[model samples]
Target: MIFIHPTAEVSDKAKIGDGTKIWHHAQIRENAEIGENCNIGKGVYIDFGVKIGNNCKIQNYVSVYHGVVIEDDVFIGPSVTFTNDLYPRAFIWSEEKVSKTLIKKGASIGANSTLICGITIGKFALIGAGSVVTKDVPDYALVYGNPAKITCFVCECGRKLENFEDNKKDNLVKGICKFCKKEIFINKNNFKKWKK
Candidate 1:
Protein backbone atom coordinates (compact mmCIF):
# COMPACT_ATOMS: atom_id res chain seq x y z
CA MET A 1 0.00 0.00 0.00
CA ILE A 2 1.10 3.52 -0.79
CA PHE A 3 1.46 6.09 1.98
CA ILE A 4 0.53 9.62 1.06
CA HIS A 5 0.85 12.34 3.64
CA PRO A 6 -2.30 14.16 4.43
CA THR A 7 -0.81 17.42 3.21
CA ALA A 8 0.00 15.96 -0.21
CA GLU A 9 -2.32 16.25 -3.17
CA VAL A 10 -2.28 13.35 -5.58
CA SER A 11 -4.56 13.58 -8.56
CA ASP A 12 -7.12 10.87 -9.15
CA LYS A 13 -5.53 9.89 -12.44
CA ALA A 14 -2.07 9.47 -11.03
CA LYS A 15 -0.87 5.90 -10.58
CA ILE A 16 1.25 5.22 -7.50
CA GLY A 17 2.72 1.80 -7.03
CA ASP A 18 2.89 -0.23 -3.82
CA GLY A 19 5.02 0.99 -0.92
CA THR A 20 5.46 4.43 -2.41
CA LYS A 21 5.37 7.29 0.07
CA ILE A 22 4.41 10.85 -0.80
CA TRP A 23 5.57 13.21 1.90
CA HIS A 24 4.41 16.56 3.12
CA HIS A 25 2.89 19.01 0.62
CA ALA A 26 3.76 16.89 -2.39
CA GLN A 27 1.63 17.20 -5.48
CA ILE A 28 1.33 14.53 -8.16
CA ARG A 29 -0.50 15.59 -11.28
CA GLU A 30 -2.80 13.56 -13.50
CA ASN A 31 -1.43 10.62 -15.48
CA ALA A 32 1.81 10.55 -13.54
CA GLU A 33 3.07 7.04 -12.78
CA ILE A 34 5.29 6.55 -9.74
CA GLY A 35 6.65 3.07 -9.22
CA GLU A 36 7.00 0.92 -6.13
CA ASN A 37 9.01 1.75 -3.00
CA CYS A 38 9.65 5.29 -4.10
CA ASN A 39 10.19 8.04 -1.50
CA ILE A 40 8.84 11.38 -2.49
CA GLY A 41 10.04 14.08 -0.11
CA LYS A 42 8.49 17.30 1.06
CA GLY A 43 6.96 19.81 -1.37
CA VAL A 44 7.64 17.86 -4.57
CA TYR A 45 5.60 18.64 -7.65
CA ILE A 46 5.31 15.94 -10.27
CA ASP A 47 3.69 17.26 -13.40
CA PHE A 48 1.51 15.58 -15.99
CA GLY A 49 2.66 12.56 -17.99
CA VAL A 50 5.80 12.20 -15.89
CA LYS A 51 6.97 8.65 -15.22
CA ILE A 52 9.10 7.54 -12.26
CA GLY A 53 10.20 3.97 -11.70
CA ASN A 54 10.91 1.75 -8.72
CA ASN A 55 13.00 2.57 -5.65
CA CYS A 56 13.51 6.20 -6.60
CA LYS A 57 13.92 8.86 -3.92
CA ILE A 58 13.12 12.48 -4.54
CA GLN A 59 14.10 14.93 -1.84
CA ASN A 60 12.59 18.16 -0.61
CA TYR A 61 11.24 21.01 -2.74
CA VAL A 62 11.85 19.40 -6.13
CA SER A 63 9.79 20.05 -9.20
CA VAL A 64 9.64 17.33 -11.83
CA TYR A 65 7.91 18.74 -14.85
CA HIS A 66 6.34 17.14 -17.90
CA GLY A 67 8.36 15.30 -20.53
CA VAL A 68 10.68 13.83 -17.94
CA VAL A 69 11.09 10.08 -17.45
CA ILE A 70 12.95 8.69 -14.43
CA GLU A 71 14.06 5.07 -14.27
CA ASP A 72 14.64 2.76 -11.31
CA ASP A 73 16.82 3.35 -8.25
CA VAL A 74 17.37 7.00 -9.01
CA PHE A 75 18.12 9.56 -6.29
CA ILE A 76 17.03 13.10 -6.90
CA GLY A 77 18.33 15.41 -4.21
CA PRO A 78 16.71 18.41 -2.61
CA SER A 79 15.56 21.32 -4.81
CA VAL A 80 16.39 19.55 -8.06
CA THR A 81 14.29 20.81 -10.94
CA PHE A 82 13.42 19.27 -14.30
CA THR A 83 12.36 21.51 -17.11
CA ASN A 84 10.30 20.55 -20.16
CA ASP A 85 9.59 23.45 -22.51
CA LEU A 86 12.48 25.51 -23.77
CA TYR A 87 10.40 28.62 -24.07
CA PRO A 88 7.58 30.02 -22.00
CA ARG A 89 4.14 30.54 -23.47
CA ALA A 90 1.19 30.21 -21.18
CA PHE A 91 -1.70 30.48 -23.66
CA ILE A 92 0.14 29.68 -26.88
CA TRP A 93 0.41 26.51 -28.92
CA SER A 94 3.94 25.79 -27.65
CA GLU A 95 3.29 22.47 -25.99
CA GLU A 96 4.14 20.65 -29.21
CA LYS A 97 7.69 21.98 -29.01
CA VAL A 98 8.36 20.53 -25.59
CA SER A 99 11.37 18.27 -25.47
CA LYS A 100 11.61 15.16 -23.33
CA THR A 101 14.43 14.23 -20.99
CA LEU A 102 15.30 10.77 -19.71
CA ILE A 103 17.14 9.90 -16.52
CA LYS A 104 18.23 6.31 -16.89
CA LYS A 105 18.41 3.69 -14.15
CA GLY A 106 20.58 4.30 -11.08
CA ALA A 107 21.39 7.91 -11.86
CA SER A 108 21.81 10.35 -8.96
CA ILE A 109 21.56 14.12 -8.90
CA GLY A 110 22.85 16.11 -5.99
CA ALA A 111 20.90 18.89 -4.35
CA ASN A 112 19.97 22.02 -6.33
CA SER A 113 20.88 20.66 -9.76
CA THR A 114 18.93 21.70 -12.79
CA LEU A 115 18.36 19.43 -15.76
CA ILE A 116 17.54 21.14 -19.01
CA CYS A 117 15.19 19.74 -21.59
CA GLY A 118 16.02 17.28 -24.38
CA ILE A 119 18.85 15.54 -22.57
CA THR A 120 19.28 11.88 -21.68
CA ILE A 121 21.37 11.23 -18.56
CA GLY A 122 22.89 7.79 -18.81
CA LYS A 123 22.64 4.98 -16.30
CA PHE A 124 24.48 5.36 -12.97
CA ALA A 125 25.60 8.89 -13.83
CA LEU A 126 26.27 11.26 -10.94
CA ILE A 127 25.58 14.97 -11.15
CA GLY A 128 27.12 17.00 -8.41
CA ALA A 129 25.38 19.64 -6.37
CA GLY A 130 24.39 22.97 -7.96
CA SER A 131 25.03 21.78 -11.51
CA VAL A 132 23.18 22.99 -14.55
CA VAL A 133 23.07 20.06 -16.94
CA THR A 134 22.81 21.22 -20.53
CA LYS A 135 23.90 18.08 -22.36
CA ASP A 136 23.63 14.34 -22.18
CA VAL A 137 25.77 12.75 -19.49
CA PRO A 138 27.44 9.38 -19.97
CA ASP A 139 26.86 6.41 -17.69
CA TYR A 140 28.83 6.23 -14.42
CA ALA A 141 30.28 9.66 -15.08
CA LEU A 142 30.63 12.26 -12.32
CA VAL A 143 29.95 15.75 -13.63
CA TYR A 144 30.00 19.20 -12.09
CA GLY A 145 30.00 22.92 -12.96
CA ASN A 146 27.45 25.27 -14.46
CA PRO A 147 27.51 23.67 -17.90
CA ALA A 148 28.35 20.24 -16.43
CA LYS A 149 31.69 18.80 -17.47
CA ILE A 150 32.91 15.30 -16.76
CA THR A 151 35.39 15.58 -13.89
CA CYS A 152 35.86 11.85 -13.38
CA PHE A 153 34.00 8.61 -12.91
CA VAL A 154 32.55 7.52 -9.54
CA CYS A 155 31.76 4.01 -8.49
CA GLU A 156 28.59 2.64 -6.98
CA CYS A 157 30.41 2.67 -3.66
CA GLY A 158 30.89 6.44 -4.12
CA ARG A 159 34.64 6.81 -4.34
CA LYS A 160 36.63 8.66 -7.00
CA LEU A 161 39.56 6.76 -8.46
CA GLU A 162 43.10 7.86 -7.78
CA ASN A 163 45.44 9.12 -10.50
CA PHE A 164 48.50 7.07 -11.36
CA GLU A 165 51.65 8.69 -12.64
CA ASP A 166 52.68 5.74 -14.81
CA ASN A 167 50.59 3.40 -16.93
CA LYS A 168 47.75 5.66 -18.07
CA LYS A 169 45.38 2.70 -18.38
CA ASP A 170 45.50 2.25 -14.59
CA ASN A 171 44.73 5.84 -13.65
CA LEU A 172 41.64 7.72 -12.50
CA VAL A 173 42.35 10.30 -15.20
CA LYS A 174 41.29 7.56 -17.57
CA GLY A 175 37.98 7.34 -15.71
CA ILE A 176 38.54 4.33 -13.48
CA CYS A 177 36.39 3.97 -10.40
CA LYS A 178 38.12 3.24 -7.10
CA PHE A 179 35.11 2.53 -4.98
CA CYS A 180 33.84 -0.36 -7.02
CA LYS A 181 37.45 -1.43 -7.71
CA LYS A 182 36.66 -1.63 -11.42
CA GLU A 183 37.64 -0.03 -14.66
CA ILE A 184 35.15 1.81 -16.83
CA PHE A 185 36.10 1.50 -20.46
CA ILE A 186 34.41 3.40 -23.21
CA ASN A 187 34.23 2.98 -26.94
CA LYS A 188 36.79 4.91 -28.96
CA ASN A 189 34.27 7.05 -30.74
CA ASN A 190 31.83 8.80 -28.37
CA PHE A 191 33.31 7.89 -24.97
CA LYS A 192 30.13 6.18 -23.95
CA LYS A 193 30.10 3.56 -21.15
CA TRP A 194 30.55 -0.13 -21.88
CA LYS A 195 31.72 -1.23 -18.37
CA LYS A 196 35.06 -2.98 -18.57
Candidate 2:
Protein backbone atom coordinates (compact mmCIF):
# COMPACT_ATOMS: atom_id res chain seq x y z
CA MET A 1 0.00 0.00 0.00
CA ILE A 2 1.58 3.21 -1.24
CA PHE A 3 0.35 6.45 0.19
CA ILE A 4 0.84 9.66 -1.73
CA HIS A 5 -0.50 12.78 -0.10
CA PRO A 6 -3.10 14.81 -1.97
CA THR A 7 -0.69 17.73 -2.34
CA ALA A 8 2.16 15.59 -3.66
CA GLU A 9 3.00 15.51 -7.35
CA VAL A 10 4.07 12.02 -8.40
CA SER A 11 4.46 11.51 -12.10
CA ASP A 12 2.75 8.59 -13.74
CA LYS A 13 6.02 7.62 -15.40
CA ALA A 14 7.66 7.09 -11.99
CA LYS A 15 7.72 3.61 -10.50
CA ILE A 16 7.08 3.60 -6.72
CA GLY A 17 7.19 0.28 -4.92
CA ASP A 18 4.74 -1.10 -2.38
CA GLY A 19 4.42 0.35 1.16
CA THR A 20 6.13 3.59 0.13
CA LYS A 21 4.71 6.81 1.52
CA ILE A 22 5.19 10.21 -0.08
CA TRP A 23 4.34 13.14 2.13
CA HIS A 24 2.69 16.46 1.36
CA HIS A 25 4.05 18.65 -1.45
CA ALA A 26 6.77 16.19 -2.41
CA GLN A 27 7.58 15.87 -6.09
CA ILE A 28 8.66 12.60 -7.62
CA ARG A 29 9.68 13.20 -11.22
CA GLU A 30 9.35 11.04 -14.30
CA ASN A 31 11.27 7.74 -14.50
CA ALA A 32 12.28 7.92 -10.83
CA GLU A 33 12.21 4.44 -9.29
CA ILE A 34 11.73 4.24 -5.51
CA GLY A 35 11.82 0.81 -3.91
CA GLU A 36 9.58 -0.65 -1.23
CA ASN A 37 8.78 0.80 2.21
CA CYS A 38 10.53 4.14 1.71
CA ASN A 39 9.46 7.32 3.48
CA ILE A 40 9.69 10.50 1.45
CA GLY A 41 9.17 13.49 3.72
CA LYS A 42 7.26 16.68 2.97
CA GLY A 43 8.56 19.04 0.28
CA VAL A 44 11.21 16.58 -0.86
CA TYR A 45 12.29 16.68 -4.49
CA ILE A 46 13.41 13.52 -6.24
CA ASP A 47 14.65 14.42 -9.71
CA PHE A 48 13.98 12.66 -12.98
CA GLY A 49 15.49 9.21 -13.45
CA VAL A 50 16.84 9.05 -9.88
CA LYS A 51 16.80 5.59 -8.31
CA ILE A 52 16.24 5.02 -4.59
CA GLY A 53 16.41 1.57 -3.05
CA ASN A 54 14.25 -0.13 -0.42
CA ASN A 55 13.64 1.06 3.18
CA CYS A 56 15.27 4.44 2.63
CA LYS A 57 14.23 7.49 4.64
CA ILE A 58 14.47 10.86 2.91
CA GLN A 59 13.85 13.74 5.26
CA ASN A 60 11.92 16.95 4.58
CA TYR A 61 12.97 19.38 1.83
CA VAL A 62 15.88 17.24 0.68
CA SER A 63 16.83 17.61 -2.97
CA VAL A 64 17.99 14.48 -4.74
CA TYR A 65 19.03 15.61 -8.17
CA HIS A 66 19.36 13.68 -11.39
CA GLY A 67 22.29 11.27 -11.74
CA VAL A 68 22.14 10.28 -8.05
CA VAL A 69 21.50 6.67 -7.01
CA ILE A 70 20.66 5.65 -3.41
CA GLU A 71 20.89 2.05 -2.29
CA ASP A 72 18.83 0.23 0.34
CA ASP A 73 18.47 1.34 3.99
CA VAL A 74 20.03 4.75 3.34
CA PHE A 75 19.08 7.72 5.49
CA ILE A 76 19.21 11.24 4.10
CA GLY A 77 18.53 13.94 6.65
CA PRO A 78 16.59 17.16 6.19
CA SER A 79 17.60 19.71 3.55
CA VAL A 80 20.50 17.61 2.19
CA THR A 81 21.43 18.67 -1.33
CA PHE A 82 22.95 16.48 -4.01
CA THR A 83 24.65 18.16 -6.92
CA ASN A 84 24.83 16.66 -10.40
CA ASP A 85 27.07 19.14 -12.17
CA LEU A 86 30.68 20.07 -11.44
CA TYR A 87 30.44 23.35 -13.30
CA PRO A 88 27.34 25.43 -13.06
CA ARG A 89 26.25 28.04 -15.55
CA ALA A 90 22.66 29.18 -15.70
CA PHE A 91 22.48 28.95 -19.47
CA ILE A 92 24.47 25.73 -19.88
CA TRP A 93 22.39 22.63 -19.26
CA SER A 94 22.90 19.21 -20.77
CA GLU A 95 22.80 15.55 -19.80
CA GLU A 96 26.50 15.27 -20.62
CA LYS A 97 27.28 17.78 -17.88
CA VAL A 98 25.60 15.66 -15.25
CA SER A 99 27.90 13.57 -13.07
CA LYS A 100 26.71 10.52 -11.19
CA THR A 101 26.75 10.06 -7.41
CA LEU A 102 26.26 6.73 -5.72
CA ILE A 103 25.22 6.37 -2.07
CA LYS A 104 25.90 2.80 -1.10
CA LYS A 105 23.64 0.74 1.14
CA GLY A 106 23.20 1.61 4.87
CA ALA A 107 24.94 5.00 4.66
CA SER A 108 23.54 7.87 6.73
CA ILE A 109 23.96 11.50 5.71
CA GLY A 110 23.35 14.15 8.32
CA ALA A 111 21.15 17.22 7.96
CA ASN A 112 22.02 20.07 5.57
CA SER A 113 24.95 18.28 3.94
CA THR A 114 25.98 18.85 0.34
CA LEU A 115 27.30 15.96 -1.71
CA ILE A 116 29.23 16.84 -4.81
CA CYS A 117 28.73 14.85 -7.96
CA GLY A 118 30.73 11.87 -9.24
CA ILE A 119 31.55 10.66 -5.73
CA THR A 120 30.63 7.30 -4.26
CA ILE A 121 29.64 7.27 -0.57
CA GLY A 122 30.55 3.82 0.69
CA LYS A 123 28.40 1.35 2.56
CA PHE A 124 27.60 2.15 6.22
CA ALA A 125 29.47 5.45 6.07
CA LEU A 126 28.31 8.23 8.39
CA ILE A 127 28.39 11.82 7.15
CA GLY A 128 28.10 14.51 9.78
CA ALA A 129 25.79 17.51 9.72
CA GLY A 130 26.48 20.43 7.36
CA SER A 131 29.34 18.59 5.66
CA VAL A 132 30.49 19.37 2.15
CA VAL A 133 31.51 16.04 0.65
CA THR A 134 33.78 16.58 -2.33
CA LYS A 135 35.14 13.06 -2.93
CA ASP A 136 34.59 9.38 -2.43
CA VAL A 137 34.02 8.16 1.14
CA PRO A 138 35.39 4.83 2.26
CA ASP A 139 33.21 2.06 3.67
CA TYR A 140 32.34 2.47 7.39
CA ALA A 141 34.06 5.86 7.51
CA LEU A 142 32.85 8.64 9.80
CA VAL A 143 33.33 11.79 7.74
CA TYR A 144 32.63 15.41 8.56
CA GLY A 145 33.65 19.03 7.82
CA ASN A 146 34.14 20.92 4.58
CA PRO A 147 35.49 18.53 1.94
CA ALA A 148 34.46 15.73 4.32
CA LYS A 149 37.60 14.19 5.72
CA ILE A 150 37.54 10.80 7.38
CA THR A 151 37.89 11.27 11.12
CA CYS A 152 37.42 7.61 12.00
CA PHE A 153 35.64 4.43 11.09
CA VAL A 154 32.28 3.42 12.54
CA CYS A 155 30.48 0.17 13.08
CA GLU A 156 27.30 -0.83 11.24
CA CYS A 157 25.33 0.27 14.29
CA GLY A 158 26.75 3.85 13.91
CA ARG A 159 29.04 3.59 16.92
CA LYS A 160 32.60 4.86 16.64
CA LEU A 161 35.10 2.05 16.31
CA GLU A 162 37.76 1.83 18.97
CA ASN A 163 41.45 2.22 18.13
CA PHE A 164 40.82 2.87 14.42
CA GLU A 165 42.76 6.13 14.36
CA ASP A 166 45.56 4.86 16.57
CA ASN A 167 46.20 1.89 14.30
CA LYS A 168 46.42 3.71 10.98
CA LYS A 169 50.11 2.89 10.42
CA ASP A 170 49.31 -0.33 8.60
CA ASN A 171 47.77 -0.64 5.13
CA LEU A 172 44.97 -2.67 6.66
CA VAL A 173 43.31 -1.74 9.96
CA LYS A 174 40.82 -3.52 12.18
CA GLY A 175 38.07 -1.51 13.80
CA ILE A 176 36.19 -2.87 16.77
CA CYS A 177 33.06 -1.32 18.17
CA LYS A 178 33.17 -0.81 21.92
CA PHE A 179 29.44 -0.97 22.32
CA CYS A 180 28.57 -3.85 20.02
CA LYS A 181 32.00 -5.51 19.91
CA LYS A 182 31.73 -6.05 16.15
CA GLU A 183 34.98 -6.22 14.24
CA ILE A 184 35.35 -4.50 10.88
CA PHE A 185 38.44 -4.65 8.73
CA ILE A 186 39.19 -1.62 6.54
CA ASN A 187 41.90 -1.07 3.95
CA LYS A 188 43.76 2.16 4.63
CA ASN A 189 44.73 2.43 0.98
CA ASN A 190 41.17 3.35 0.14
CA PHE A 191 41.66 6.53 2.19
CA LYS A 192 45.00 7.57 0.68
CA LYS A 193 43.57 10.64 -0.97
CA TRP A 194 42.04 11.92 2.28
CA LYS A 195 44.70 10.84 4.77
CA LYS A 196 45.74 13.28 7.45
Best by lDDT: 2
Worst 10 residues of 2 by lDDT: 162-171
TM-score of every candidate: 0.87, 0.93
Q: Over the full model, what C-alpha lDDT does candidate 1 score relative to the true structure?
A: 0.86
Q: What are the C-alpha RMSDs, in order, of all predicted structures? A: 4.3, 2.4
Best-fitting candidate, scored by TM-score: 2
Write the residue-wise lDDT of candidate 2 on 110-145 in tens digits. Answer: 999999999999999999999999989999999999
Query: Roughly what TM-score does model 2 have, to 2 decimal places?
Result: 0.93
Each model's lDDT comes to 0.86, 0.94
Off by over 4 Å in 1: 162-176, 190-196
